[model samples]
Target: MSDHHIIDAKKMMITLEDVNKWYGQFHVLKNINLRVKPGERIVLCGPSGSGKSTTIRCINHLEEHQQGRIVVDGTELNDDLRNIERVRTEVGMVFQHFNLFPHLTVLQNCTLAPCWVRKMPKKEAEELAMHYLKRVRIAEHAHKFPGQLSGGQQQRVAIARSLCMKPKIMLFDEPTSALDPEMVKEVLDTMIGLAEEGMTMLCVTHEMGFARTVADRVILWIAGKSSKKRHRWSSSPHRNQQGPGSFYLR
Candidate 1:
């Protein structure tokens, strides 16, 4: 875990090299270097405030990094508006909170982005929306507004909305963290299906069971940097040894 991993360069889909970020004078990410291969599922586990969310945000340029490089789907991340928009189209993100538009019905919420950002025709966008809604098993709720659905159902719609854009990579920022205990599985099940279909994903979550079962690698972040990464099949006796707030990436 202490040494750098050697991965085949040709297979890489995302690369973050010496990436750093800060909030005012507080350095948040410290020389982060990571490589994700196409179709690889990486689960980032960590305690709260350890920068897992910030790290993922940088990938999609939701939060600007102060230094280093982040390249997603071969596009280098930078301050250019056109490049940022292009990269975003290729990368889909699901937040911890279901950030669906309350005014829009499930179908409209899913269709809006593709129609606007992607310039897809409305009818075609709705068709794409329904396809993913069905994939997430929430097609029957398509006519309901966000507030009309349960937490789990709304989150599924949020996921379907992301999928409607046909992204090459999916980023989940604690997708199940805000759900009720009973509802977590429905969302996770949808994510598992995506993983099984070979979607390249970077998920920031503490769902260890999901990590153990679906992830190709589990990364642990501590004090704003990645400290350990292990293969799914590798045994680590010290996995749960850290303090509650100490943090982990996988």
Candidate 2:
């Protein structure tokens, strides 16, 4: 990486220009464009069909684009499966659903990816797994199965699992949306700790509090499009939403 990459460090690991997508005749994304930098923190929010999740999903090729370009960590996502795989290994994602394996112990969940994807030594992978589990404040529950843990604990495990991949960037799609009201804070706190440590994150969430604390900017997804243009909330944003809708990163 050159100084251009360094100075432009916030330049964009994921970039989309004039991107469009559709599901059958239903057009989902409309000329979507987004740019995420090396360690910048961004929050994406809006009404349900606003296409917040679709935007990030496009970065990893989870949702195929009908038109436009997506560049992840310098690699352009395309028809090549190999390219998509490379991008995924460099980018980690934590979803709304905890998505933990019910039959697997928490420790196993954390270790499986590093061992298989990174080809890390079993002992080393286990050590790294333990390290991240501790970071998520769940090392004590490592041997317990997902069914045995609370929703909050499972989300912690999910975070640990993603970190074990050692991704250069992290994507969070409404990570705390599925948690119980009280359990939301724990996971958000864990994310806060990571943000404080300078992890680049693109989060789709209604956690205005979390966004206010750490976001460099806020990106809104209109209908199904996430614009390349972004608005900087130099200071903290204020919340003014009434009950029916949710406010994020305020």
Candidate 3:
């Protein structure tokens, strides 16, 4: 990565302090605290209903947290519509399913946000969309509709769509869980390449191999709280001396 692309080590990219959330009577997130630096690659791993997805969702204000502070880039997340819009604009999210529009071509799907949200001209948006589609190795399928593509290819297009937004942070919530075993690697490779380019990422995945390959630090979340014990890439993934729990990457 060029020096310009290299993120400042001293600056924090995302911070969550004493974050808490509830759905009816059930508490989903409990006093969650986290700090992420620029260019950092962190993964959130845990069993089902462990609040891994909800945590990332809260960062972008997709699911509002009942209490606690969430600061993204420099803006704090709260009830302010401007703050939420600002955070959403800077943070791009890819869900488990490839949420591509079936009616639109892959190129159109990629260009929609840049054109409508970023207010870029159609020609410029197309160019930008193509740039990212090529990066994800899906430019050839630009004119094809989402339904015409395979699962992996559709996921790659979704990734390209997110990249077109020029987001400061990328969040992946089990991006590969919906794909077949054979197709998982291609998506993971795309993500690895993104990480190489110094994009700050928070991925919620169970892919331990991918985690070991790209993660700077791994955090394990159990129930609603993150474990105090930190695990590195060099550690044996199978052996969790601390106890039984899922491992998250940072």
**What TM-score would each prediction reach against the true structure?**
0.89, 0.87, 0.90
Estimate every model's Cα lDDT from 0 to 1.
Answer: 0.85, 0.82, 0.86
Give the residue spans of candidate 3 off by over 4 A. Answer: 1-10, 232-250
Best by lDDT: 3
**Best candidate, TM-score-wise?**
3
Error of 1 at 216 (Å): 0.4
TM-score of 1: 0.89
Taking the tens digit of each residue's C-alpha lDDT, what string does model 1 give over 170-221? 9999999899999999999999899989999999998987776677777888
Please rank every candidate by lDDT, starting with the best: 3, 1, 2
Worst 10 residues of 2 by lDDT: 239-248
Candidate 1 accuracy as lDDT: 0.85
